[model samples]
Every structure is written in structure tokens, then in C-alpha cells.
Target: MTDPADGQAGSDGGHIDSFDDLDIAPRVRQAIADVGYESPSPIQAATIPPLMAGRDVVGLAQTGTGKTAAFAVPILSRIDPTARHPQALVLAPTRELALQVAEAFGRYSSHMPEVRVLPIYGGQSYGVQLAGLRRGAQVIVGTPGRVIDHLDKGTLDISQLDHLVLDEADEMLTMGFAEDVERILAETPDSKQVALFSATMPSAIRRLAQRYLHDPQEITVKAKTATAQNITQRYLQVSHQRKLDALTRFLEVETFDAMIVFVRTKSATEELAEKLRSRGFSAVAINGDMAQAQRERTINQLKNGQIDILVATDVAARGLDVDRISHVVNYDIPHDTESYVHRIGRTGRAGRSGNALLFVSPRERHLLRAIERATRSTLTEIGLPSVEDVNAQRVARFADSITENLGSDHLDTFRQLVENYARDKDVAMADIAAALALETRDGGFLMAPDPPEGERGERRERSPRRSSGGQFATYRIAVGRKHKVSPGAIVGAIANEGGLTRGDFGNISIRDDFSLVELPENLDNETLSSLRHTKIGRNPIDIKKDHGPPRTRGGAKRGGGHGRDGYGKRSDSWGKRSNPRVAGRGRG
Candidate 1:
């Protein structure tokens, strides 16, 4: 017999005419209509019914596939406005993502009066989070660390949790919060409905599902295989420090109707936009913190050509469909493969061909590979702009501006002044014009000289042979295989934490409970100490020479392989395990 939760009887292949057709409450239907969503996305269509029926679901969908609404709509429908306890817990990896999910819940819960949502993360004050908890939020969205902190302090009680969601399970694992996740789940009641969403099902994530979820109904929404075929993908493998310079150079040489530059943080959006504005570009920043009126005005300016460039974080840029956006710049490599696809999707809309440029630091090369594998598209390498190229573009733009201004009567006075200067200086008219041209150009007349041959800013070439003859020096990190550290995590940590450019490191090998990385041999002791203090996935580095068995700073055995759960096993002072909630069906 067909299960009632399946809701497949509509005969239109699960597509509902309205939220009413899905047996949802009137408030939910009104909220759905207010959001202007006429039909459910594929993932939404498949997942919502079972969710509304209170069945556990495991959804596999790429970012931007409308997964947020898939679970959100059903969960919001289940909210009892008077109860005021945490009935739904949505755990995300990053603070930014947690805020985004909270905002989403707010949007869909608009018609449901007295429904409150709170987002908790590490950077915020615990007192503020505790206050919100006291005020009785119906739904809680938080990062694992902060959520675990709250659970242990007796400030958060999830005994009433009817819904538990693990958003971006793979990302939580990649960030080394798996053990914390397990602990969070262990605190939840076993009967709670759990939803674990991820883009990829790696072994670790699969193990999480097996251990925590109970006969979950799996739903996978395949990512769009091709970027809008209309978009051309190009990337420049530059260090993070050089990205601004590279982007500036690219802007000088390339022309576009309007451009969207994607950055990782809200602060970066403002900072980059301000820098571009100071550099004479009509630019602005868009982020989630902006008021609705402000966001609309900024977007309108871009559409009307008043703003030529917009620096924005991903959450603010979502649902923005602008026909004038001709270029998309990944100012920061996206956090995951799906984000790459979404950032590029900002352009190339409405059958328009667009250009996408990705700036990749050496440490983010693994992200590049993941994106390539996910999208099945090749990204062509883009070279830095030459001085000649910048000069040529400047000259062309100057001439065009002059020709346009010549049609105005105001040029007559300037023309006479130029003629007077030419006659007084006994300079030929052409020479006088040339001098004026040179003076009018921006970026100055003299270009900076290229670096010397061995230091031309190209990545240092490394020999595969492990001998000291090469430019790299091999150093051992005290946490490795037994610690559950992967080579990619090592690379990401060093590149982001140690301030080492991707080109500053080479081959990496993972051994039992530690790893070794080949870095530039010229690294000073200060840099080495800084590296030793660096933390990857929240574990401090005991970076020392790779002699043999793992030892403490004082040379004694440092316990068994950083503990069984690897970096995720660290304990918190708040009376709870610091591990991320295990992928599971329980509520914490």
C-alpha cells in the first residue's frame, strides 16, 4: 500500500498547485505566497511531504537548490506559537550560514505570530545568546561550538525538540567538528525527526548517517551539470594578498556593463567596496546586515549604471537576478563547490553570455578541484595584466571621453587655453597634446618595474625528489592520520592560518597521528613559531621536527593519537564535549 506521507496521488508528479494542495495550514500558504514562490523546487517537492508527515528525511542537494525552504516550510508549519521552547534546532558550520538559515526561517514564518528564531555562533557573547534563550525562541540556529556551549551551561533545553536538522553535514566534517556534532545529537531525544542535508556523501558523513539516522528516506537533487553554457569560466592562481592588485589590473583591461564581486565575509564586502570606490570605481557593498531599503537602492544603482561594481557576500546576493550584470568575480574562492556554482550563476542569466573570473589562492586549490569535479567544467587560467595592456586601455578610454566631451560647447575654453600654452612654450601642438594626455592618465605615468627573474611572482617551482636540493623544507605536524587530519585540511590551515601563500608550500603526506608539509626553506624561526601556534579545525599545532613517535612539548607521549574522534574530541569547560553533534536522529 502507498504511504499517505508519500503524497504521490496528485498525478502531476508531486507538483502542487498551492501550499493548500499539500495540506499545509493557511498561515503557511500565505507565507509561501508572500515569498512569491508559485511552485516548489524539485527538492522541496520531494522532501516537504514526508517532512510534514513527521518522517525523518536525508536530503542530498547542492547549494542554491532551494533546500532551505524544503525543510523550513514544513518545520514552520509545526511551530506551536504558545509553547515558546526550542522545538527546532538547525545546526550549520559557519556563523554566516547560521544567520542565513535563521533569516530564512524568519521569512517563511512571517505570518505565524509570536514565532521567534535565534542564531548562535562563537563570535557572539554568551550572555546575549542566553538572554535570547530565556526569552523563548521557538527555533534555534547555531554553529556546533556555540550550541554545545549553550547545551552544557543548562541554558538550552532541547527536550521539546520535535525537529533536528544538520545542514551541510559534509562541511561540519571538513571543519573537524564531527565529534561535537555527535555529542550534540546524543543530548537530543531519540524520537525527534532528523534531517541531514549535504552535497556529498563522503565516508565520514555516511558513517554519521548510519550511526545517527534511523531508516531515513534519502532524496538527492543533482547539481546543474553545466554552468550556464553562456558563461565563460576563467581563473587566476594568485596568492590572497595579491588578489586586490590582480582584480584592479583586470578591471583596467576589461570592460563590462556591470560587475558583481563575491567575497567571503560581510566585512570584506564593505572593505573591498570602499577600496574600489577610493580607487575611482562607482562601487558599493551589499550584505545581510543592510536594511531592505538600502539593499534595494544599491541594486537599483547597479541596474541604472550609477554603480558599476558591487562587492557582496553570498547571502545578500541570493535571489538577485540582474540583467545588467555582465561579469562575476570570485574575489574569494567559495567555501564549497556549490557556492562556486551559485556565485557564477549571478551572471549569465536570461540567455545572456557572461564572464566569470575566480581568484584562487594556492591553499584553495582543493576547492577548485572539487568545483571542477562537481560542475564537470574546465576553468581556463588567466594571466595577470601587463603594464602595456593597462596603458593601452587607459589611452583608449581617455580618447573616447575626449571625443564625447568635444560635442559640448564647454571644450572651447580648454581648447583656447591649450593653444595658448602651446604657443607660449614654443611647443608643437602635438607635443602639447601628448603632455596633457600623459598628465590626465590615472595610475601614474611610470609603471612599476617587473620583479627580477627568480622573483617574478610566479609560484616557486618544486622538484618531486624529497632531497634538500629543492627550495622546500619538509616539516612535521604532530597531528595526522590517527588524528583524522587530511592533507587538504593541512593545506587549508597553513595557507589561511600561517599567512603562507599557496605557492609557499609543496607536497604533503599524512602519517598515523601527524602530517608533514614542505614549506619554503627560508622560513624564519618566528614564522615557524607562528605556524606552531596555528590551529586547523580548532586544534593547536604542536609543529616540531618529524623525528618519530608523537610527543608532548616536553617530549613525553601525548596520549593516544589525539583521541579516537580525532580533532573533534576536545572537551569544553562548560561541562560538555566540544565535538560537533554526530549526524543523527536525536535532539540535543
Candidate 2:
């Protein structure tokens, strides 16, 4: 096997069928097999060899995809067991994960008595950790917060580090520990091999990857069930009257790098592609009806970034492996559950999270339920972006376009021209800018003005604002986009059918199999009974009061979170030490 980085021969590369193929110490292999790891998972198989070869790797896969062993096995194989100073640092998001990872290291190197590992985290005794540090450990696994605390006091050392791992990067991004993670990485030697594993690559994490990781090989592993835990599955309940419009609204608000829209028929693929193109989207269609050459060109255009969206039937999209595609829209419900899974799998590839939206009509409820049961994960229902949402996004995009041209050579010419016109008309610069904003958007909103609730009759019930909190119950509705539900229709059905006012409701969240609604806290039995047998559009809703104990009166968690525990120090640690500067321009 050859290395992609420096063209060096790697004795263990490509597929490995057994633990022995990993080329690690015999004791390490024995311990792995003793734990009953019969075979390496896809991520472990692909990543272990590159990592073991000392190449930087970025692992892309969903949660629970066996990422721990992928990096751990390789580092353990390469580490000098006799060294007492820490040579590797594993950074995780939470204290629990830190401990779990340290335990795994212990289990993997069970026979190697000289190999020492330390688990550092908040809520642990500092004296204990300091003693372990003084005694010297070869591997250190810690959460980012606690790791920074040690770095501040000059107690922990990475001057001789060989490996650095950033595990659960997406979780850290969510917990707002990205800055800490970056700072900690900066303190490490540049020669150290870096490995990062993330369930999703939102732009922030992507930027961090670009800054920190050297040229790295990318690997992606699909979930064992062939469905991704990272892709958000949603179904939009649309009447035939509004399917096209609902889809258009979605395109307006979504942030995607590339998109694929699937339809049942070849002709629908072409038609939808043309319709989207007419709306100024860079869209083209590929179908069984297209010539092979034409199909190839369309796919290439999508792959090369010339086109942003592809409209294709399942047959035409076979063997497609484009990682840039970030969204998969089932513009038409699939004939079966397998087709549904295959279509969405195209987007959420290489460990990047993708969004999947389905357009289900009134009679497609059973198909939606079948998909949910097969995937073993419930989809979150989301409302169509309102007119305000579309308008806000459009204006923001126009502002970006103008800002991009700010450094152009001819910008002064245009800037002066606008200034002269403003002076002649005695108008405010702000007024001139607002007029330019309207003109840039083509003198109209990106979408037609959304109809008021009364204007659309029963289907026009406006969604209530999301509740701030305070005992509003989260009710579950069996009906969803599968039943052609619009938020307006949901709000209307509940208000008129259940004798509740608009104020009695809060924001609604829909899923493929069901929908969640916020209702006034502690409604009377009479009102709750009236909510039964409520019909929206063509389907009757099976509504019930939901009981979720984890949620508090107003929605936020009771303790905020365990992540922000102040200064993870033991009570008796060398009297009261000043809290180290946690986040700023530079690390102490």
C-alpha cells in the first residue's frame, strides 16, 4: 500500500479483514479480540490504516460509527509504551466521554503495563490528576475545558506529543467550545499527526478544519442500517394545490452547497428542473429518458460546481457519489421505504449532516409511517418558511452580493454615481441604499406575499410564535405532512374544532410520523376532549396531551448545562487559586 501524502509504502493499507491486519502489538490484537471485536467497522477499516501510517485523517460518519477505535488503535500501535511523558492528547466534549475514552485506552492496552493513561475532566480532584501528571502518563484524554485549566497552570505538557485527536467536534461546536479546542491545538507541536471526527460539518467546524488539519485523507461510513443519524428527515404535508409553492418557499430559506430533487417520473424531473431554472436557480434534470452522454454531462456539472441543483429519477441517479450534495428533496413520495432511504442517503455522505424533505399528500400517511418504522428514527416536522423568513433571507443575500463588490476596481465609479444621485435628489444615503436593495431583488420579493389566515380560508391559519416558556404542554398530533397538514391548517383545526383561541397555541413542530404542538398549560377536560376527532385537510388528527418530563415549564433545561461548571478545581487544591483566563486572544 502507498501513502497518498508522501508516496511512502504502507505495509498495511486498504481493506483489512481481521484485527491482526492492523499491524499493532500482539498484546493489543489479543485484547481487542478478547473484547469480541470480530471485525473492523467501515470507518475503522479505512481510517486505521491511514492513521497507523502517520497520515492526518478527517473522519466523516454519524455518531456511534465506531470512531473511537479507529484513532485509538492506530495511536496505541504507534505509541512508545516505555515513555512516561504524555505523547498523545485526546480531547472530547463532555466529562463522561473523556472517562469512557480513557477506559477504552485502559482496556486496549491491558497487557502493556508500562503504558499509562490519564483521564482529566471537570468535577475531578486536581491533586489526584496532578499526582498522575507528575508520575507521567503516555496518553492523556480530557475534555477541552479541563485541558485548558491544566495548560494555564503549566502542569500539563505537550512539548513531546506525537498524536492529537479531536473527538465529537460537532458536539463541541454545539457546546461553544470551538475556541478552546482551537487554542489547545495551537499549543501542540506542528509535527504531530492530527485526527478529527465529527458527525456534522457546519461551516464553523469546516473553517477550523482548514486552519488546523494538514492535507488529510477523507473517509465516510454509512450507518449500519443504511440510514444516517445525521440527516434530518422531514415531511411536508401539502395539498396538490400548494406542493410547488411549498417547495419554492423551502428553496428560499435553506442553506445548501448542492441539492438533489427526486421525482417518480422522468417527465416530472424535467418539468421540475425547468420550473426551478425559470425561478433563477442553477438547476438541470437527468432522467432515464436522457441520452447517456447528456446524463453524464448533467452529473458532471453538479460535481464540478457549475450547477447547484440536480433533478433526477432514482434510475438515473444510480451509482452517484457526489459529496457536495447537501440536500435531498423527495419532491414525490417514493414507491417504497427502500427508495426513500436510497434517495436521502445521497446527501448525508462523508459524515456531513444533510437535510431531507418529503412532499407527502393526504393519502401517503402509511408510506411515511413505513419509512419511520424501517429507519428506527423519528423525523422532525418543520413548517414552510414564512414570507417574512423568505424576505429576510433574500435581503440578507442581496446585502452579501453588494458587499462582495465593495473592493472592485469600478466600485468607486458606482459609489460616486450613487452619491451624486443622492445629492441631486436630497435623499438620505440610507434611503438610497434601501432603494438599491429593492432593485437588486428585482423590484419584488423572492416569494409572493404569503396570504393572511383569513385570505386562504381554512388552510390559512397562521402558526403561533414559538413559546418562550411557562407550562405550555407539548401535544402530539398523529397527522403530519403525510396528511397534507399546513401549520395554518393545524392552527385552524385546533382553534375552531377544539374551541380554542389563537393565543391558546404556540409554535408547531412536525415530524414524518407525527407533529408536536404547544397548547396552553393545563387545559380543562372539556377542551381537551373537544380537541379529539379534529380533522385537518383530508385526514382526521389523532390528538393527545403529551407528557415529557425532561422539559421544564418554559422549555429550557433546569440546570442550564454541566459544560459550564466554573473552574473545574477540587475544593482543597492549594488554597484558592485565581481562575485562569479561559478564553481570549492567546492562551496563558
Candidate 3:
């Protein structure tokens, strides 16, 4: 296979000038013209040539760089239209992205009537997907989970697959689809070409590429795109414990027509939306688990003024465009800057002024700086609204409420009641009115009192001594020094299996034949079960909650029960050192 010179994309004569210069199928070129695409995007220009030459590729470009066409055009150029089974498979992280990639494939293959593309994902009926598969699609675009389901059921056959594309591979891993993605790749033919694309190359992603990809061509598009000038971006450095309180106070003081709050987990979307609703906001949640019909309804509610706030994950909110979304709140900071860009892009549409607020914890300040450097824009630092600020806004809103009710026909009855009460009790009219107002309020307070001096809204992190006070839980896995497992491998396995980030893990202590890890105390049963079966090399983790003291494989205590005894000293396999990070956040 031929390689591009220096493996870099430029506007010079070294690169393909336009769509006309791409040595792709004639029908695809016609479809490209029909879709009004003229010049090749940087990613497309750098990616297509190697892909057409049947070489593995690793594309590193931020969102909105025409990455879809970069891979789609090339795949469509080479796939056999008359194949009975899928010739190309694309794994996406979310259902929305799956549908989007499938649509792009269909559009590019419009002139090739014999070629068919099928999108399989959660929330869609299996019967429908099975029908499409039976009809023999040439290209399959699917999320990892649903694709795994089909593969296990023997309905979708990719044995003859010639091309495999992992789009937004980092997002898939972040959402806990790493195992599914690996299994799918393992199932594909050995000769299949692989293309892995991500906005950022984290250690996990690099390890995946190293293991699965051949000598892939690497292409990177500098993430220096212009953000909307009308969008005001700001960040608040608040502790994780204070985020909810800060968000509520910000909502009270900020004048917003509509807002979207982005979180990392699907469960978090629902939890945050519920919290917002309890706090009296018209809020709802959307995620990949919801049916397509329900997702559409939720989005429609936002557009038609029925819901003021949408709490969503990155995948659920992909391609979401609402002109009335005046504010975008990053309730949970994204794993990378690419996701941050996508989250804020939901607002600032049609040249309208918008607000983008990011909540960054102290531990995540590095991520904040990364975003700033990548976007080439400095985010203004802001503090959460103080009690006084909230109270002032509330008082103004109360006055406006009184003004709005002045012309109401029912106000005379209440006014007469207040007058009668004042006359009977011989109380001042102002005092009577205040009493009535207090009675009407649920919490019975029109103004907020100032907090104690130096005590703002932030809460201290939990003491490590407290076993379950929002701290880490110790779990023992059956693989350790004897199994030849390193601390990094164990960390990666648990993080991927649990769909957790680095912050979720605290410390790891490896002993002879068994290892102990400190993870978040709130891990659900399903995640624990998944981790129990996760393999480091050839041994299943067999993980379980460690209620007893740490022990060796022979059931004897090694040293003190304290997990951080060895700290940073590396000893023999029987006395390997721990992760060495602090016990709370493990970010030493």
C-alpha cells in the first residue's frame, strides 16, 4: 500500500485538491457533488488516500472537521455493493451517532442503488434490525452494545467484513464500551482494514491502537477552530460537593430562555434532571437508553417551550440543534476538549448570543487548561452566585409577580381578606400583607440569610478514615503478583469495566495471588459483576467487596492491614508497591 508523503495534510499540491482529485468510485464522486461538497476537508484529505490504499489509519481530529465524509467516502469507494453480508462495519458510541453515520453512508451511496446501509442501536426494535440484516446490507453502522447483541444472536454476520471503523473511539471507551468494542474487533476477519479515530489520544486509546491496529497512518488536525464570537464562555472552580448548589444558584441569577446541562453518565442525566425538577425547574433528561420516539418528544418539548432545561449526556445530545437554547451548562466536565466543544456548540446557533458555563472541580483544573489551550480562547473565571445574589434575584422576581397579579380579577378577594384581617386584629396593613406573603410561600422566606463568614458553599472532601462516608470502597480481585498483573493493567481493567474515570479509583495494592483496589463506594451490582469476570491476561478478576483484611492467597496476613503501607516502594511480587497516590482522589 502507498502512504502519503510525511503523513501530513496541507493545502499545497502534495494533497488532493478537491473531491475531483479523490480516486474514488464515480458514483460516490457524483453523490459528493450532489451533496454540494467541493474541497476535501483536512481530515478527509489526509485520511482518504491511505484508506483507499487499504491501509490502517488513526485519525486525530476534533469534531466538525468533516470526519464523517473522511471515512465514509473511502469506505463507500471500495465496498462490494453485491455482497450478501456486511462488507464494512462502523462502531459508534451512541445511537444518535450511529444513525448519523448510517445516514452519511446512505447519502454517499445514493447513486449505487445496490448498496444498502443499516443502523443498529439500542432503543430500536430488534425485529426491524433483523429484517434489515436478512435483506443483506453492505454497510452496517451500529453502537457497540446493540452490535454485540446481534453478533451474539447470530443474526449479524461480519465474518467477511473488509473495513472496520471505530468513530469517536475515545467516547466509546469513556462510556464503558471498551470490552464490547474489543470483542467486536476480535470477531472480525484478520485481514480487515481498521481505522481508529479520536479527538484526543489518551493512554487507554493509545494502548488500544497499539494492540489492535497495524502500522496505521496517523493524522492530526490542530484543534484551533474558532468558537462562536457571540458565545460567552466562563468556568467556575468549585469542589464536586458544591456543584449542585452552585448550579441552582446560577440558575436563579442568570436570565436564560432555555438551557442544556451536560453530564457524563446516563444515570447522572436522570438524577440531575430529577434534582432540577424538585428545585422547581421545568427539566428533563435524555440518553441513549430512551427510545427514539421518546427522545424526539423530549427534544420537541425543549423546542416548543414546554421544558426549559435538558440534562443530557454527550451521545444523547449529539447533533442536537435548538435555537432557543440560550445557555449550555457543563455540569460534569467532559473527558476531553472535543466533547467540551460539542457540548457548548448546542447553543450559540444562528449568530445568537449565548452563555456557556463549565463547572470545574479543583482536581479538574488541568482539563480546564487543556480546553483553553486547544480552543485558543481563555475562559473567564467566575464564582457561584452568593446568597445575596440569589436573594436579590428572588426579591426582584417576587415584585414582578406582584405586578403581574395586580390586574387579575381574583386579587380583589384576597385584598379584601387581608383588609378584613387587619381591621379585626388591629394589626398594621404592611404587617398583615407580610404575614399573607409568608403564608403563601412554601419555605416561608423572601430573602436568604448570609452564610457564616469564610464558609461559602463549598464542602470539604470526605475523611479517608470514614469507611463509607462518600469515600472509596476496598475490593479484592483474584489476580495479582502471581498472575503477573501490573498496577496499571489492573487500573485500566477496572476503569474500563466500570465505566469510570481516574477520579473514581483511589489506591491499588497488589499482594501475592490477590490484589486489593479502592474504588467508589457506590458502584452498582452490574458493574461489580462485569469487573468480576474481567480478565487481566488469562485469569478472571473474580472481584468481590473486601470486608475482611487484606490477605495472601494462602489466607495469611502479609503486613499491617493498612493498604498504603508500602506506599511508593517497589518490592518483590509478593510485596509489590501500591498505586502510591493519595487515598482520596489518587491524583498525586
RMSD, every candidate, angstroms: 9.2, 25.2, 7.0
In candidate 2, position 503 carries an lDDT of 36
Candidate 1 structure quality by residue, lDDT tens digits, 259-332: 99998667678899998987778889998789999999988888888888989887788778899999999988
Ranking by lDDT: 3, 1, 2
Candidate 2 C-alpha lDDT tens digits along 153-217: 89999988999998878766554466568788889999999998886778987887888889988
Summing lDDT over every window of 10 consecutive residues in candidate 3, give the lowest-scoring window: 1-10
lDDT values, one for every candidate? 0.73, 0.71, 0.76
Worst 10 residues of 2 by lDDT: 579-588
Whole-model lDDT, candidate 1?
Answer: 0.73
**Cα deviation of 2 in candidate 3 (Å)?**
28
Quote model 3's TM-score. 0.74
lDDT per residue, candidate 3, 96-131, as tens digits? 567668877877889999998999875556789999
Superposed model 1: Cα runs more than 4 Å off: 1-20, 202-214, 361-369, 416-443, 446-449, 457-588
Least accurate stretch of 10 residues (summed lDDT) in model 1?
A: 1-10
Once model 3 is optimally superposed onto the true structure by TM-score, how far is the C-alpha of residue 404 displaced, in angstroms?
A: 1.5
